[model samples]
Target: MDPLERLSSPAPEFLDRLAASTRALHWLVALPVLLLLLTGLTNFWPELKALHVGGARVFAWLHVLIGLGFAVALVPSVIAILMRRAARRDARELLAFGLDDYLWLQHRVLRAAGLRSVGPRVGKFNAGQKLNAVLSAAATAALMGTGVVLGVNYWSKDVFDVDLVGAVFRWHTVLSVLLLPLIAGHLYMALLNPGTRESLRGVTTGRVRRSWAERHHGAWADRVREERRAGEG
Candidate 1:
Protein backbone atom coordinates (compact mmCIF):
# COMPACT_ATOMS: atom_id res chain seq x y z
CA MET A 1 0.00 0.00 0.00
CA ASP A 2 1.12 3.59 -0.64
CA PRO A 3 2.46 5.41 2.39
CA LEU A 4 -0.21 8.13 2.26
CA GLU A 5 -2.96 5.61 1.68
CA ARG A 6 -5.25 4.98 4.63
CA LEU A 7 -8.09 2.59 5.31
CA SER A 8 -10.63 5.41 4.89
CA SER A 9 -9.38 6.45 1.40
CA PRO A 10 -6.30 6.93 -0.71
CA ALA A 11 -4.28 10.12 -0.20
CA PRO A 12 -5.00 13.26 -2.13
CA GLU A 13 -2.37 14.51 -4.58
CA PHE A 14 -3.55 18.14 -4.58
CA LEU A 15 -5.06 19.81 -1.54
CA ASP A 16 -7.41 22.76 -1.58
CA ARG A 17 -5.78 25.77 -0.05
CA LEU A 18 -7.15 29.21 -1.02
CA ALA A 19 -10.86 29.46 -1.59
CA ALA A 20 -12.37 30.98 -4.74
CA SER A 21 -13.63 34.11 -2.96
CA THR A 22 -10.22 34.71 -1.46
CA ARG A 23 -8.66 34.57 -4.91
CA ALA A 24 -11.32 36.95 -6.23
CA LEU A 25 -10.63 39.53 -3.53
CA HIS A 26 -6.90 39.22 -4.17
CA TRP A 27 -7.31 40.14 -7.85
CA LEU A 28 -9.76 42.92 -7.03
CA VAL A 29 -7.31 44.67 -4.73
CA ALA A 30 -4.21 43.75 -6.70
CA LEU A 31 -5.13 45.59 -9.89
CA PRO A 32 -5.69 49.00 -8.33
CA VAL A 33 -2.70 48.58 -6.04
CA LEU A 34 -0.41 47.78 -8.95
CA LEU A 35 -1.71 50.76 -10.91
CA LEU A 36 -1.22 53.07 -7.93
CA LEU A 37 2.39 51.90 -7.67
CA LEU A 38 3.03 52.52 -11.32
CA THR A 39 1.46 55.97 -11.36
CA GLY A 40 3.00 57.00 -8.06
CA LEU A 41 6.50 55.92 -9.08
CA THR A 42 6.33 57.41 -12.51
CA ASN A 43 5.50 60.80 -11.02
CA PHE A 44 8.76 60.74 -9.02
CA TRP A 45 10.98 59.48 -11.83
CA PRO A 46 12.44 62.49 -13.66
CA GLU A 47 12.97 60.73 -16.98
CA LEU A 48 9.55 59.10 -16.90
CA LYS A 49 7.93 62.33 -15.80
CA ALA A 50 9.64 64.24 -18.65
CA LEU A 51 7.97 62.01 -21.23
CA HIS A 52 4.56 62.96 -19.93
CA VAL A 53 5.78 66.54 -19.21
CA GLY A 54 2.58 68.56 -18.94
CA GLY A 55 0.51 65.45 -18.19
CA ALA A 56 1.79 65.23 -14.62
CA ARG A 57 -1.56 66.42 -13.26
CA VAL A 58 -3.33 63.61 -15.12
CA PHE A 59 -1.15 60.90 -13.63
CA ALA A 60 -1.40 62.41 -10.18
CA TRP A 61 -5.19 62.36 -10.39
CA LEU A 62 -5.06 58.78 -11.65
CA HIS A 63 -2.99 57.80 -8.64
CA VAL A 64 -5.49 59.39 -6.28
CA LEU A 65 -8.40 57.63 -8.01
CA ILE A 66 -6.72 54.25 -7.74
CA GLY A 67 -5.82 54.87 -4.12
CA LEU A 68 -9.46 55.55 -3.29
CA GLY A 69 -10.53 52.37 -5.06
CA PHE A 70 -7.91 50.30 -3.25
CA ALA A 71 -9.02 51.66 0.11
CA VAL A 72 -12.60 50.81 -0.70
CA ALA A 73 -11.65 47.33 -1.95
CA LEU A 74 -9.93 46.49 1.33
CA VAL A 75 -13.05 47.23 3.38
CA PRO A 76 -14.89 44.11 2.24
CA SER A 77 -11.97 41.85 3.11
CA VAL A 78 -11.81 43.35 6.57
CA ILE A 79 -15.55 42.94 7.00
CA ALA A 80 -15.34 39.29 5.94
CA ILE A 81 -12.69 38.56 8.54
CA LEU A 82 -14.82 40.15 11.23
CA MET A 83 -18.09 38.49 10.17
CA ARG A 84 -16.90 35.11 8.90
CA ARG A 85 -15.21 32.36 10.87
CA ALA A 86 -13.24 31.00 7.93
CA ALA A 87 -11.72 34.37 7.18
CA ARG A 88 -10.82 34.77 10.83
CA ARG A 89 -9.01 31.45 10.83
CA ASP A 90 -7.15 32.38 7.65
CA ALA A 91 -6.17 35.73 9.13
CA ARG A 92 -4.82 34.02 12.22
CA GLU A 93 -2.86 31.57 10.13
CA LEU A 94 -1.42 34.31 7.96
CA LEU A 95 -0.43 36.51 10.89
CA ALA A 96 0.77 33.83 13.33
CA PHE A 97 4.49 33.78 14.13
CA GLY A 98 6.08 32.02 17.04
CA LEU A 99 9.20 30.05 18.01
CA ASP A 100 8.95 27.60 15.13
CA ASP A 101 8.70 30.42 12.60
CA TYR A 102 11.68 32.20 14.12
CA LEU A 103 13.76 29.04 14.11
CA TRP A 104 12.85 28.35 10.51
CA LEU A 105 13.85 31.87 9.53
CA GLN A 106 17.18 31.63 11.36
CA HIS A 107 18.05 28.35 9.67
CA ARG A 108 17.03 29.71 6.29
CA VAL A 109 19.29 32.73 6.68
CA LEU A 110 22.22 30.66 7.87
CA ARG A 111 21.78 28.25 4.96
CA ALA A 112 21.69 31.17 2.53
CA ALA A 113 25.00 32.44 3.95
CA GLY A 114 26.60 29.02 3.38
CA LEU A 115 26.50 28.07 7.06
CA ARG A 116 25.21 24.67 8.20
CA SER A 117 21.99 24.59 10.20
CA VAL A 118 19.13 22.19 10.54
CA GLY A 119 15.89 23.46 9.09
CA PRO A 120 12.93 23.72 11.41
CA ARG A 121 9.36 22.77 10.64
CA VAL A 122 6.99 25.71 10.19
CA GLY A 123 3.26 26.12 9.80
CA LYS A 124 1.47 27.72 6.85
CA PHE A 125 3.62 30.84 7.11
CA ASN A 126 7.18 31.31 8.39
CA ALA A 127 8.49 34.43 10.13
CA GLY A 128 9.69 36.13 6.96
CA GLN A 129 6.38 35.62 5.23
CA LYS A 130 4.38 36.89 8.19
CA LEU A 131 6.70 39.87 8.45
CA ASN A 132 6.24 40.60 4.78
CA ALA A 133 2.47 40.40 5.07
CA VAL A 134 2.41 42.62 8.12
CA LEU A 135 4.74 45.19 6.60
CA SER A 136 2.83 45.24 3.33
CA ALA A 137 -0.45 45.76 5.13
CA ALA A 138 1.08 48.53 7.22
CA ALA A 139 2.47 50.18 4.14
CA THR A 140 -0.92 50.00 2.48
CA ALA A 141 -2.60 51.64 5.44
CA ALA A 142 0.07 54.33 5.77
CA LEU A 143 -0.07 55.18 2.10
CA MET A 144 -3.82 55.40 2.19
CA GLY A 145 -3.78 57.73 5.15
CA THR A 146 -1.09 59.98 3.71
CA GLY A 147 -2.56 59.86 0.25
CA VAL A 148 -5.95 61.02 1.52
CA VAL A 149 -4.43 64.05 3.17
CA LEU A 150 -2.41 64.89 0.11
CA GLY A 151 -5.38 64.37 -2.14
CA VAL A 152 -7.58 66.59 -0.02
CA ASN A 153 -4.95 69.29 0.09
CA TYR A 154 -4.41 69.12 -3.62
CA TRP A 155 -8.09 69.65 -4.30
CA SER A 156 -8.43 72.34 -1.66
CA LYS A 157 -5.32 73.89 -0.17
CA ASP A 158 -7.39 75.34 2.68
CA VAL A 159 -8.13 71.81 3.92
CA PHE A 160 -4.61 71.18 5.34
CA ASP A 161 -1.73 73.48 6.13
CA VAL A 162 1.43 73.63 3.98
CA ASP A 163 3.59 72.28 6.85
CA LEU A 164 1.33 69.25 7.28
CA VAL A 165 1.27 68.52 3.56
CA GLY A 166 5.07 68.80 3.38
CA ALA A 167 5.48 66.34 6.27
CA VAL A 168 3.12 63.77 4.82
CA PHE A 169 4.72 64.18 1.39
CA ARG A 170 8.13 63.22 2.75
CA TRP A 171 6.68 60.25 4.60
CA HIS A 172 4.74 59.10 1.54
CA THR A 173 7.86 59.16 -0.61
CA VAL A 174 9.90 57.26 1.99
CA LEU A 175 7.24 54.60 2.44
CA SER A 176 6.85 54.17 -1.33
CA VAL A 177 10.59 53.65 -1.76
CA LEU A 178 10.73 51.16 1.13
CA LEU A 179 7.71 49.19 -0.12
CA LEU A 180 9.27 48.53 -3.54
CA PRO A 181 11.86 46.08 -2.29
CA LEU A 182 9.28 44.24 -0.20
CA ILE A 183 7.06 43.95 -3.24
CA ALA A 184 9.98 42.78 -5.36
CA GLY A 185 10.93 40.12 -2.85
CA HIS A 186 7.31 38.99 -2.65
CA LEU A 187 7.13 38.63 -6.44
CA TYR A 188 10.48 36.84 -6.55
CA MET A 189 9.42 34.34 -3.92
CA ALA A 190 6.13 33.71 -5.69
CA LEU A 191 7.32 33.63 -9.31
CA LEU A 192 11.10 33.17 -9.39
CA ASN A 193 12.42 31.63 -6.21
CA PRO A 194 12.82 27.92 -6.81
CA GLY A 195 11.97 26.76 -3.32
CA THR A 196 8.60 28.38 -2.72
CA ARG A 197 7.48 29.38 -6.21
CA GLU A 198 5.19 26.40 -6.41
CA SER A 199 3.09 28.08 -3.75
CA LEU A 200 1.87 30.48 -6.41
CA ARG A 201 -0.32 27.69 -7.66
CA GLY A 202 -2.05 27.52 -4.31
CA VAL A 203 -3.13 31.14 -4.52
CA THR A 204 -4.08 31.01 -8.19
CA THR A 205 -5.61 27.56 -8.55
CA GLY A 206 -6.77 26.99 -4.96
CA ARG A 207 -4.70 23.83 -4.78
CA VAL A 208 -1.07 22.81 -4.40
CA ARG A 209 0.90 19.62 -4.83
CA ARG A 210 0.56 17.61 -1.62
CA SER A 211 4.22 16.58 -1.72
CA TRP A 212 5.40 20.17 -1.95
CA ALA A 213 3.13 21.21 0.94
CA GLU A 214 4.40 18.32 3.05
CA ARG A 215 7.99 19.38 2.51
CA HIS A 216 7.60 23.14 2.91
CA HIS A 217 4.56 23.58 5.12
CA GLY A 218 4.42 20.29 6.95
CA ALA A 219 2.49 21.51 9.97
CA TRP A 220 -0.26 23.06 7.90
CA ALA A 221 -0.30 20.09 5.54
CA ASP A 222 -0.74 17.68 8.45
CA ARG A 223 -3.60 19.79 9.75
CA VAL A 224 -5.21 19.69 6.33
CA ARG A 225 -4.91 15.93 6.28
CA GLU A 226 -6.41 15.59 9.73
CA GLU A 227 -9.28 17.89 8.80
CA ARG A 228 -9.98 15.86 5.69
CA ARG A 229 -9.93 12.58 7.60
CA ALA A 230 -12.27 14.00 10.22
CA GLY A 231 -14.69 15.12 7.55
CA GLU A 232 -14.61 11.65 6.01
CA GLY A 233 -15.24 10.07 9.36
Candidate 2:
Protein backbone atom coordinates (compact mmCIF):
# COMPACT_ATOMS: atom_id res chain seq x y z
CA MET A 1 0.00 0.00 0.00
CA ASP A 2 1.06 3.59 -0.57
CA PRO A 3 2.37 5.58 2.44
CA LEU A 4 -0.66 7.84 2.52
CA GLU A 5 -3.07 4.90 2.30
CA ARG A 6 -1.20 3.07 5.03
CA LEU A 7 -1.37 6.09 7.29
CA SER A 8 -5.04 6.64 6.64
CA SER A 9 -6.27 3.05 6.61
CA PRO A 10 -7.94 1.42 9.56
CA ALA A 11 -5.50 -0.55 11.64
CA PRO A 12 -5.56 -4.32 11.23
CA GLU A 13 -5.16 -4.98 14.96
CA PHE A 14 -5.06 -3.28 18.34
CA LEU A 15 -2.71 -3.47 21.32
CA ASP A 16 -3.47 -3.02 24.98
CA ARG A 17 -1.95 0.09 26.51
CA LEU A 18 -3.48 0.96 29.88
CA ALA A 19 -4.88 -1.59 32.28
CA ALA A 20 -8.54 -1.59 33.28
CA SER A 21 -7.64 -0.35 36.77
CA THR A 22 -5.57 2.49 35.38
CA ARG A 23 -8.29 3.67 32.98
CA ALA A 24 -10.83 3.72 35.78
CA LEU A 25 -8.49 5.68 38.02
CA HIS A 26 -7.91 8.12 35.17
CA TRP A 27 -11.60 9.00 34.81
CA LEU A 28 -12.16 9.08 38.53
CA VAL A 29 -9.81 12.03 38.71
CA ALA A 30 -10.53 13.44 35.26
CA LEU A 31 -14.22 14.21 35.80
CA PRO A 32 -13.69 16.06 39.06
CA VAL A 33 -10.64 17.84 37.73
CA LEU A 34 -12.71 19.09 34.81
CA LEU A 35 -15.28 20.41 37.24
CA LEU A 36 -12.56 22.05 39.30
CA LEU A 37 -11.08 23.71 36.23
CA LEU A 38 -14.47 25.01 35.12
CA THR A 39 -15.42 26.31 38.54
CA GLY A 40 -11.92 27.61 39.12
CA LEU A 41 -12.47 30.21 36.43
CA THR A 42 -14.12 32.42 38.98
CA ASN A 43 -10.97 32.52 41.05
CA PHE A 44 -8.78 34.10 38.39
CA TRP A 45 -10.50 35.75 35.46
CA PRO A 46 -11.09 39.45 36.19
CA GLU A 47 -14.51 39.66 34.57
CA LEU A 48 -15.85 36.70 36.54
CA LYS A 49 -15.17 38.47 39.83
CA ALA A 50 -18.08 40.81 39.12
CA LEU A 51 -20.54 37.89 38.98
CA HIS A 52 -23.06 37.65 41.77
CA VAL A 53 -21.27 37.20 45.07
CA GLY A 54 -23.56 34.34 46.13
CA GLY A 55 -23.02 32.47 42.88
CA ALA A 56 -19.29 33.00 43.10
CA ARG A 57 -19.26 31.69 46.67
CA VAL A 58 -21.15 28.63 45.52
CA PHE A 59 -18.58 27.91 42.81
CA ALA A 60 -15.77 28.50 45.26
CA TRP A 61 -17.15 25.85 47.59
CA LEU A 62 -17.82 23.57 44.65
CA HIS A 63 -14.19 23.91 43.63
CA VAL A 64 -13.17 22.85 47.09
CA LEU A 65 -15.40 19.80 46.92
CA ILE A 66 -14.01 18.83 43.56
CA GLY A 67 -10.45 19.28 44.69
CA LEU A 68 -11.04 17.18 47.76
CA GLY A 69 -12.71 14.50 45.65
CA PHE A 70 -9.81 14.58 43.21
CA ALA A 71 -7.41 13.81 46.00
CA VAL A 72 -9.66 11.11 47.31
CA ALA A 73 -9.84 9.59 43.85
CA LEU A 74 -6.10 9.00 43.82
CA VAL A 75 -6.07 6.88 46.95
CA PRO A 76 -6.56 3.47 45.36
CA SER A 77 -3.90 4.01 42.69
CA VAL A 78 -1.45 5.11 45.35
CA ILE A 79 -2.10 2.05 47.47
CA ALA A 80 -1.98 -0.28 44.49
CA ILE A 81 1.31 1.18 43.35
CA LEU A 82 2.77 0.74 46.79
CA MET A 83 1.62 -2.83 47.12
CA ARG A 84 1.80 -4.17 43.57
CA ARG A 85 5.23 -4.62 42.04
CA ALA A 86 3.99 -4.38 38.48
CA ALA A 87 2.17 -1.16 39.20
CA ARG A 88 5.31 0.31 40.70
CA ARG A 89 7.33 -0.68 37.65
CA ASP A 90 4.74 0.78 35.27
CA ALA A 91 4.66 4.03 37.21
CA ARG A 92 8.43 4.32 37.20
CA GLU A 93 8.72 3.53 33.51
CA LEU A 94 6.02 6.01 32.61
CA LEU A 95 7.50 8.84 34.65
CA ALA A 96 11.29 8.44 34.30
CA PHE A 97 13.08 10.13 31.38
CA GLY A 98 16.24 8.63 29.93
CA LEU A 99 18.84 10.11 27.59
CA ASP A 100 16.87 9.00 24.52
CA ASP A 101 13.80 10.76 25.87
CA TYR A 102 15.77 14.04 26.00
CA LEU A 103 17.13 13.54 22.51
CA TRP A 104 13.69 12.70 21.19
CA LEU A 105 12.29 15.87 22.71
CA GLN A 106 15.11 17.97 21.24
CA HIS A 107 14.39 16.63 17.79
CA ARG A 108 10.66 17.17 18.23
CA VAL A 109 11.19 20.81 19.14
CA LEU A 110 13.52 21.34 16.20
CA ARG A 111 11.15 19.65 13.78
CA ALA A 112 8.18 21.54 15.15
CA ALA A 113 9.98 24.77 14.38
CA GLY A 114 10.69 23.64 10.80
CA LEU A 115 14.37 22.94 11.32
CA ARG A 116 16.37 19.93 10.20
CA SER A 117 16.69 17.32 12.97
CA VAL A 118 17.22 13.62 13.53
CA GLY A 119 14.92 12.02 16.04
CA PRO A 120 15.75 9.29 18.53
CA ARG A 121 13.80 6.10 19.16
CA VAL A 122 10.59 6.41 21.09
CA GLY A 123 9.50 3.93 23.75
CA LYS A 124 6.09 3.29 25.29
CA PHE A 125 5.81 6.93 26.32
CA ASN A 126 7.32 10.09 24.80
CA ALA A 127 9.18 12.82 26.66
CA GLY A 128 6.16 15.09 26.56
CA GLN A 129 4.00 12.41 28.17
CA LYS A 130 6.61 11.72 30.82
CA LEU A 131 6.97 15.38 31.63
CA ASN A 132 3.22 15.76 31.73
CA ALA A 133 2.91 12.83 34.10
CA VAL A 134 5.54 14.24 36.43
CA LEU A 135 4.05 17.69 36.40
CA SER A 136 0.59 16.21 36.92
CA ALA A 137 1.72 14.24 39.98
CA ALA A 138 3.43 17.29 41.43
CA ALA A 139 0.46 19.48 40.66
CA THR A 140 -1.86 16.97 42.29
CA ALA A 141 0.15 16.90 45.50
CA ALA A 142 0.52 20.66 45.63
CA LEU A 143 -3.12 21.33 44.93
CA MET A 144 -4.28 18.71 47.37
CA GLY A 145 -2.17 19.99 50.26
CA THR A 146 -3.05 23.63 49.72
CA GLY A 147 -6.68 22.69 49.15
CA VAL A 148 -6.95 20.85 52.44
CA VAL A 149 -5.57 23.82 54.33
CA LEU A 150 -7.91 26.21 52.57
CA GLY A 151 -10.89 23.93 52.97
CA VAL A 152 -10.25 23.59 56.63
CA ASN A 153 -9.98 27.34 57.02
CA TYR A 154 -13.29 27.79 55.27
CA TRP A 155 -15.29 25.63 57.68
CA SER A 156 -13.73 26.58 60.96
CA LYS A 157 -13.69 29.73 63.04
CA ASP A 158 -10.22 31.33 63.30
CA VAL A 159 -8.50 27.95 62.78
CA PHE A 160 -6.21 29.42 60.14
CA ASP A 161 -5.42 33.12 60.18
CA VAL A 162 -5.95 35.44 57.21
CA ASP A 163 -2.25 35.70 56.33
CA LEU A 164 -1.72 31.94 56.27
CA VAL A 165 -4.87 31.39 54.29
CA GLY A 166 -3.83 34.09 51.83
CA ALA A 167 -0.46 32.46 51.30
CA VAL A 168 -2.01 29.05 50.68
CA PHE A 169 -4.55 30.64 48.37
CA ARG A 170 -1.79 32.19 46.30
CA TRP A 171 0.00 28.88 45.92
CA HIS A 172 -3.22 27.18 44.94
CA THR A 173 -4.02 29.81 42.34
CA VAL A 174 -0.51 29.84 40.91
CA LEU A 175 -0.44 26.06 40.60
CA SER A 176 -3.83 26.04 38.91
CA VAL A 177 -2.57 28.56 36.34
CA LEU A 178 0.45 26.42 35.58
CA LEU A 179 -1.64 23.29 35.17
CA LEU A 180 -3.93 24.84 32.55
CA PRO A 181 -1.51 24.61 29.64
CA LEU A 182 -0.63 21.02 30.41
CA ILE A 183 -4.30 20.11 30.26
CA ALA A 184 -4.84 22.07 27.06
CA GLY A 185 -1.84 20.58 25.30
CA HIS A 186 -2.88 17.10 26.38
CA LEU A 187 -6.38 17.60 25.01
CA TYR A 188 -5.04 18.97 21.73
CA MET A 189 -2.72 16.04 21.19
CA ALA A 190 -5.38 13.47 22.00
CA LEU A 191 -8.30 15.05 20.15
CA LEU A 192 -6.88 17.24 17.39
CA ASN A 193 -3.37 16.16 16.41
CA PRO A 194 -3.82 13.72 13.54
CA GLY A 195 -0.62 11.93 14.40
CA THR A 196 -1.80 11.20 17.94
CA ARG A 197 -5.59 11.28 17.82
CA GLU A 198 -5.61 7.56 17.03
CA SER A 199 -3.95 6.81 20.33
CA LEU A 200 -6.86 8.19 22.32
CA ARG A 201 -8.42 4.78 22.09
CA GLY A 202 -5.46 3.41 24.03
CA VAL A 203 -6.37 5.55 27.00
CA THR A 204 -10.13 5.20 26.88
CA THR A 205 -10.45 1.58 25.80
CA GLY A 206 -7.04 0.23 26.81
CA ARG A 207 -6.30 -0.67 23.20
CA VAL A 208 -4.93 1.12 20.14
CA ARG A 209 -4.40 0.35 16.51
CA ARG A 210 -1.31 -1.78 16.00
CA SER A 211 -0.19 0.47 13.16
CA TRP A 212 -0.59 3.50 15.34
CA ALA A 213 1.33 1.91 18.18
CA GLU A 214 4.17 0.70 15.95
CA ARG A 215 4.67 4.08 14.33
CA HIS A 216 4.57 6.15 17.50
CA HIS A 217 5.96 3.72 20.07
CA GLY A 218 8.25 1.57 17.98
CA ALA A 219 10.57 0.42 20.72
CA TRP A 220 7.90 -0.64 23.16
CA ALA A 221 5.66 -2.03 20.46
CA ASP A 222 8.46 -4.22 19.13
CA ARG A 223 9.26 -5.43 22.59
CA VAL A 224 5.66 -6.39 23.22
CA ARG A 225 5.61 -8.37 20.02
CA GLU A 226 8.84 -10.08 20.95
CA GLU A 227 7.51 -11.02 24.36
CA ARG A 228 4.29 -12.31 22.92
CA ARG A 229 6.09 -14.53 20.39
CA ALA A 230 8.49 -15.79 23.01
CA GLY A 231 5.61 -16.67 25.30
CA GLU A 232 3.77 -18.54 22.56
CA GLY A 233 6.76 -20.43 21.30
Best by lDDT: 2
- In model 2, residue pairs whose N, Cα or C atoms come closer than 3 Å (at least 3 residues apart or on different chains), thus clashing, are none
Q: Candidate 1: which stretches are off by over 4 Å?
A: 1-12, 50-56
Residue-level lDDT tens digits of model 2 in 113-214: 999998876888899889998997788679889988988786774798899899999999899889999889988988989888976787799888788788
Q: TM-score of predicted model 2?
A: 0.88
lDDT of 1 by residue, 106-189 (tens): 898999999999977767777887898788888878988898888787778998889989999999989988888998898898
- TM-score for all predictions? 0.87, 0.88
The Cα error of candidate 1 at residue 200, in Å, is: 1.4
